[model samples]
Target: MDHIRRLLGRVTAAALTLLGVSVLIFAALRAMPGSYTELVLGPLATPEQKASAAASFGLDRPVAEQYGHWLRNTVTGDFGTSLVTRSPVASEFADRLPVTVTLTVLALALTLLIGVPLGVYTATRAGGGRGGAAGRLLSAFGMSLPEFVLGSLVVFLFTRYRLGLSVGTYTPWSEGPLASAGSLFLPACVLAVFCTAATARTTRDAVLGVLVEPHIAAAVARGEPKGFIVRHHVLRNASVPVLTLVATLSAYLLGGAVIVERLFDVPGLGSYLVDGLDRRDYAVVQAGVLLAATVFITANLLVDLLSGLLDPRLATAAKGAA
Candidate 1:
């Protein structure tokens, strides 16, 4: 029952956060200087034409009424038509969302695979050894490089070396899964570098904190194998903070995907959002922002629940409160 209540509360909070995001996005777009009317009809459009365009787009309605209408339609699964493309916003999202998701997921996988082991190795050798120093230096270097710079470097290296890798091109799944993965691999690596550095540092700190606990010393004195002790005791306790950091970083990955997508010419939601902003396509931009917020919120909620599962004290506290 406590778990159920906690889950319900999280879902409610996520819904409320998404609602706030929608409101902010709508109001911010409206608050911006100039009019979508001018962008759509051009500067030379007559006053009568602009007025007609505004009315047709429902721009003449009161701000509150417009928001209310948008909110209601959104609740009913209607995201409206794009002013520039005349396509349904939902359809546009459907086409582009998977690409962004794939990039984020791929980046996260690489981060975990590379960062967790590096962190563990560094933590185990934390006492001023050369290995520890090298790991720390590498993490610092990875974290210092900006995503665009890293991306450009990767592209230049791959192209300059003629490494037989495609750059600045997106291959759809219909072409072949291998080709699609190949196309995204470089960008995913670019996105993962910073996340990997951050994750490695976080994991190292968490592990180091766990390493000094009395139980760890007891296990070590009891003649337990180093690998077994670290695996069963060190990692299990250290996972909570690492999980939290990963959850927070997922949002960063999504946001970074925008610039990476543009740089690599990937036709993902980030690029779609950019195009929408450039053309003043409010519907596309609104829907894109809301969808991204929804994904981030949902991911965080799941991570919170998972964290509770991993740390029984959380569930115990919730039950006691209930």
Candidate 2:
């Protein structure tokens, strides 16, 4: 009951959060100084032409009324025509969102495969071993580098060696799965590096904390087998935190993919976002912001619900706090 209640509360909160974001974005964009009509329709456009353009897009209305129309239309999958491209924003998003989704999914998979086991290895050997030492250094190293610089370096290395990276092309899975993978793999690695480091460090710390508990030490002194100890206690207890870290890192993957996508020349939402903002394409910018906010809140809500379900202690804590 508590879990369901918490989930319901968060879901409701997420909806409100998204609404607030859309309103804020609308206010901020509309609040910018200068005549939006002049900007969109061009400075040289006559008063008649500018008024017609504003009226056509319903921008001639009061801000609140315009926002109301936006809310209604956005809910129904109509983002309106782009001011710059004069294209339907829905069509633009349909072409772009999937590419980003695929890229982030690949990066996250790589993060888990790299971080989890290495973290376990370091935690299991924290007393003193090369695994702990090396993992610590590597994680620190990854954290130190900027993501764009890292992407650039990867591009340089891969392209210099003619490693079949093919940085300037985006192939869809429908075309050829292997070709698509090859195209995205390098950029995904560039994006995944920080997530990998963070997850490893977080996992290592969680496991180390678990390993130091009196019960864990007691089991160790009682001649418990290493695999048995790890499976039964270390992983079972430590996994809650590891799961939380992974969920948190997912946001970073989404945000970082923009720069990586730009570097790789991939036709994803990130590039669309950058281009829209640069050109002041209102529909594209609005759609990008709403889509990103939705993804972020939804991911976080799922993470919280899953955490609550997987960890009985969280329920107990909530009850106590109540």
| Backbone clashes counted, model 1 | 0
TM-score for each prediction?
Answer: 0.95, 0.91
Residue-level lDDT of model 2, residues 238-282, one tens digit each, is 887777777666655554367888888888888888777766667
**Candidate 2 — worst ten consecutive residues by lDDT sum?**
247-256
Clashes of each: 0, 0
Candidate 2 lDDT score at position 133: 94
lDDT tens digits by residue: candidate 1, 1-322: 6567778987998999999999999999988877788877788999999999888889899999989998899999999989888889998888877788788889999999999999999999999889999999889999999988888888788778988787888888778977888889999988999889989999999999999999999999999999999999999888888888888777766643777887788988887888888788889888878877876787788777787778788778867887
Task: Give the CA lDDT, 0 to 100, for residue 145 in model 2.
Answer: 81
Clashing pairs in 1: none
- Report model 2's TM-score to 2 decimal places: 0.91
Which TM-score value belongs to model 1?
A: 0.95
Model 2 segments beyond 4 Å from truth? 33-42
Name model 1 segments beyond 4 Å from true: 320-322
